[model samples]
Target: MTRITVLGGTGYAGRNIVRVAAERGHTVTAYSRNEPASPVEGVEYRTGDVQDPEVIRAAVTGTDVVVSAVSPRGELEGTGKLRGIERRVAEEAARAGVRFGVVGGAGSLFVSEGGPRVADTPEFPDAIKPEAAELAAVLEDLQSSAAELDWFYVSPAGGFGEWAPGEATGTYRTGGDVLLVDESGESQISGADFADAVVSEIEHSEHRRERFTVAY
Candidate 1:
């Protein structure tokens, strides 16, 4: 079984991943700012601050993969701070010979080949621009600054997150940075299916050191 560590383990994506990985018989440890309301069975939950490098190192050191599902909200606000957390975790994972996998945003994805990123789309809203832009910077930094690390940034389709809260079909489609849409022309994936894709990739190692997306 792969020993996996998840940062922001109580958050939506992290919590789901922790549950999925644990259910699949992987050794899972969850690190977040607070304990989860309903912690997953057979999983170790660790409460800590991502800003502390020592805390991050402790979480990732002996794990086979570190899934960074941290979102820039609450105590983790600010783009620079978010970037710092990603960097610290990536550095620690690299030093410890662990893979660094990120739960990335669709904003960094491309609409067409050699085209503008989703964040730069004219139709993109200005309200959520700050968070989207920060994620875009995270992707850029991961490819440039943390290039030496074995990393995979998994970006969900456009209609992901708590707003939708769709149910899983035990199925999902994979794609590169280009946006993916279903037969109904919708860009979405259930949280459960997203977690399945992640753990499946972890087991199979199909996409290595690159960014990929998941959708219905």
Candidate 2:
């Protein structure tokens, strides 16, 4: 079984990844600022700050993959904080010889021809812009990193998250950067289905050294 460390493991996306990974029998260690109110069985929960490189390194020790699911909120300060955290995670993962994967924002995903990002669309909420920008910066850093450090940034479709929980058919479409929309013209997937795709990537290594998006 693959040993995995999930940074920001208590967040919406992180919890799903942790749950799915544990259900699949992979040893999962969840690193977050606070422990989960109800921790899932078969997953180890550790409380620590992601900004600390040494702490992050300790959490990732003996793990094959590190999934970053942290969402940094607010304005410029928040963006700087997230950048620091991402850099620390990448540096520590490289030092520990572990593969890194990130749950990136849909803001970086391409829309129509010569159009704006999904986050830039009118439908995208203004409140989440800062967090999306932070994720985009982290993705850019990962993409420009050296080849020896294997990293993948996975971005979900436009209508991701709790509000738009699409039915899980145990299947979804995957694409690189471009947004994936179903035949009905909806771009969304359930948390479970997104988790399924994340776990699949962890096991199969299909999209490596790049970013990918999922939808149903």
Task: Choose the strongest candidate by lDDT.
Answer: 1
Ten-residue stretch with the least lDDT total in model 1: 139-148
Clash count for each candidate, listed in order shown: 0, 0
Off by over 4 Å in 1: 145-148
Name the top TM-score candidate: 1
Residue 54, candidate 1: Cα error in Å is: 1.3
Q: What does candidate 2's lDDT look like per residue over 31-145, in tens digits?
A: 9888898799989999987667678778768899999888775222465788777888788788778999999888888786567888888888888888888888898898888
Query: What's the TM-score of each model vs. the native?
Result: 0.95, 0.93
Worst 10 residues of 2 by lDDT: 71-80
Q: lDDT of all the models against the reference?
A: 0.87, 0.85
